[model samples]
Target: MTDATARPVRSSPRPTGTPLRAFGALMLRDTRVLSRELLPFIVRVIMQPLLFLFVFTYLFPRMGGGNGMMMGGGSFATVLLPGLMAVAIMFTGIAAVALPLSTEFGVTREIDDRVMCPLPVYAVALEKICFSALQCIFAALLVLPLAYYIPSTPVLLHVSSWPVFVAVMILASLVSGALGLTIGASVQPRQIGLVFSIVVIPITFLGCVYYPWALLSHVRWLQIVVLANPIVYMSEGLRTALTPGMPHMPVLAVLAGLVGSLAVLGTIGVRNFLRRVIS
Candidate 1:
């Protein structure tokens, strides 16, 4: 016979929380998990952008790779700064949302725990998007310092309008999160790797990240084609806000693209998420 004192203590069950509380709790859970993996998170966020800046800004310029490698003979670092930040934000959203969501939805079934929360299913998807946006914002902040100092040339940043800068950052981050959500909900776990190859690669290369979009006037047809890429707006938008000296798309067009993409991607992501959860 076991002694009463030796037996494990049972905790009382708590009621399912209200929707706002549930949402906050879910966000908190993600925060705790990320905190535990802080090292890996930092590495994942910094490695690519850091290496890219080092090679292109520091090494290539020093190695007799002339201003031809630069953007219109201005400092490459200035052009690269906004672009790298955009890439950082985009990468963070996909990594934070898509990879984990696919695994949880497919193999681990860990999503069930979150789904069983008292909140609505669409709320769940929104939480994922919101959380990923937070991460994207944070990832961009992390890249900012690295982009500033690591380059051989000076990185010039002049925020023409504070409100525009703030608006673009928030809107662009939401678009990225929504895109990640759509991919996570729609793609099968086994085929997720294909997303990086087909979708991610093409978008990054064509995103106007390495150069100004206005320069693409020489390739007018290609310019029209790349406008379809959401990331083109992101890179150009950041260039508008941070590097006003750089050639970028109009503020109106950038805002329009981001808002439209957010609406489209967010709707599809929520619908797909609900279907996946119910099925």
Candidate 2:
């Protein structure tokens, strides 16, 4: 006999939207947030590159410091323009991913909300990387015209091959984004400032932003050591594609190194992100 007091069981309904739809919604939300902060974003994007161009490319040259002079008669502005663009890409990529990640993993705990969304954990990581890459590309584009024209020293930008140029830019952005993801995942919030001091400073100065990698041939040990830096490949790749006459790393080597970095760093970053979220 059935009991008169028996209660009915209720089952939760399954979530309706496709994973792609969820991913799109998340991306759209992020895009809106980014748009609202566009003015600050533009300031952050333009400040360092503009100053670097102003000081080294314009002020110093006008003051007779011969800032535009390089060994073998290469234009310093030409060499610097690519490196500046690389710096823009790298800095923007890293900051875009890392800063918010620090907050998300800290007091705000916003990442918890993201992880709760109907998406795979790895998809969240991929979203961060793709968004950061887009920001890096935008930063690069914005910096290019300013770097080209603002410098009192004339910059000779001769695109040897559009395909190669585009390839380098794309790869550079991906590598920087991957690097940001890895760093953001690995570092604790308290140590973020220290990471910037120790990791980022060395990367910027040693990345060959102010000079061509070929100049380092005289200092063989230094040249070999700086090769470990991803920015070397990025700067040299730009130099190779943009100003062919400048002595830069071999194109094949740059491509191979960037691809390897993307593979290793992207994997590690996603794994770390998953662990962070799950924990």
Candidate 3:
């Protein structure tokens, strides 16, 4: 063969901007997938929060005069609104990321495609977080009206610290997403039900969904246990932002702990997920 014919043709170098473009495309693709699968996720996210709203905001106010503000001290509805909204974000993050992750890692082996993407392993994990965080925002909006209408007492919906509220909302979603990643990577697909029964229940009860960490002082030991719960920080942080008058954990301390814990847990989850995929 001639020297020219023997030489192999080289393709143009891959685009230098491929990573950003790919990341955006990946985000949009996941968003479309989530949109199609949204109904069940929405239902699951809203159900438990709604139940708590009705029982505490609607029922308890009439029966016990607590309305929604931490067993009758503050505006029960107002207090529960932010706290429960935080809880809903937590649930949405878990349901959107964790449950499907187990399935993808198990029955479907669908995560293999994600691993094959040109992005770093962390990008795949980040995609999960981004997808679930979007759901968290949606769930928060869906439950806001309930927060407004359900309480018997005159409830406030102050947003004096709009920036803080938004920041805390994002923080709450990140914490939940990190927790979901850890749980998703740690559990077997068949054992996810066990997570719901044990992990989810304990987190919801101990997470300050119904009361602030301050009120838990009466049960000091339980308080310590729940103080370790990320949800407590998220709930308290959110409540503080929404209700300026409500007492809460020191914002700096709670935010620091939550962000730090999420970093640690999320690192472990990424390592675990990468190992699982490669194996």
Candidate 4:
């Protein structure tokens, strides 16, 4: 037999762009799975933020003592609604996605199933980010009806700066997702509670969610510390975009800060996730 006839020919390499296709496939598959798991995810994302808005905005003024920020003849809901939206998005990443990721990696080994997909490991992480970001978006929307309901006065939102508000939400979601990835990969399932107690809760309180950065000017050290928190920038940016009359930081700088931090943290988290997978 002729050698050419006897031996099978090798196929040429597939296109280098195959990784992107593979990446897209992974994202689609995970999104499908995520949709099926939506109910509890929705509940978890909405619960805390709703509770806070109900108790603080609705109950506080009813009981008497909340300043004008409560909607009843107050601007309380207007100033705080955007920040609460951000907080809900942030918690979707930290509590809903991150803690579960710790369990998938440790107890159930579910991350193994994800890593087994025919794509770069980074693509798997990207899918996770996309899923978590969707939850963040959902959480943001869920807060809307509550925003109108809680304040005794009318809730007024100036949505003229939608362009910058969109930028802020995207940047905040990316940062929160990266942070979830990093913390998930680093901690064991047993230690996730500690992470929530130490890292997540502190970040939330200091993130400038309840008030504008200008309001924190009195505590110079606290202001300096919050400058390092991505949430502060996100909350302040959202306020600037959605409320022109409110005091806030520069929208451009805050957006830049959030995007920059997301890039840095996301790069590190993806690298670490890859290492964990390969190990």
Which candidate number has the best lDDT? 1
Expressed as tens digits, the lDDT of each residue in 1-279 for candidate 2 is 999899888898766876788888888888999999999999999999888888877887888866565643576778888888899999998998888888898977789999778889899888888888888889988988886688877787788988878888889998898889998998998998999999998998999887888899899999999988888888988988988888888899989978887898899989998888888
lDDT of 2 at 175: 89
lDDT of predicted model 2: 0.86
lDDT tens digits by residue: candidate 1, 121-183: 899999999999988888888988897788887788889999998888898899899999999
lDDT of 1: 0.89
What is candidate 4's TM-score against the reference? Answer: 0.90
lDDT of 4 at 204: 80
Task: Kindly give the stretch of ten consecutive residues in candidate 1 with the minimal lDDT sum.
Answer: 65-74
Let me know the TM-score candidate 2 reaches against the reference structure: 0.91
Candidate 3 local Cα displacement, residue 173, angstroms: 0.6
TM-score per candidate, in order?
Answer: 0.91, 0.91, 0.91, 0.90
- lDDT on C-alpha atoms for all candidate structures: 0.89, 0.86, 0.79, 0.78
As for lDDT, the candidate ahead, 2 or 3, is 2
Ranking by lDDT: 1, 2, 3, 4
State the lDDT of candidate 3 residue by residue for 42-116, as single tens digits.
787778778887887788767865434454357667767777887888888888778889989986798988767
* C-alpha RMSD values across all candidates: 6.9, 3.4, 2.4, 2.7
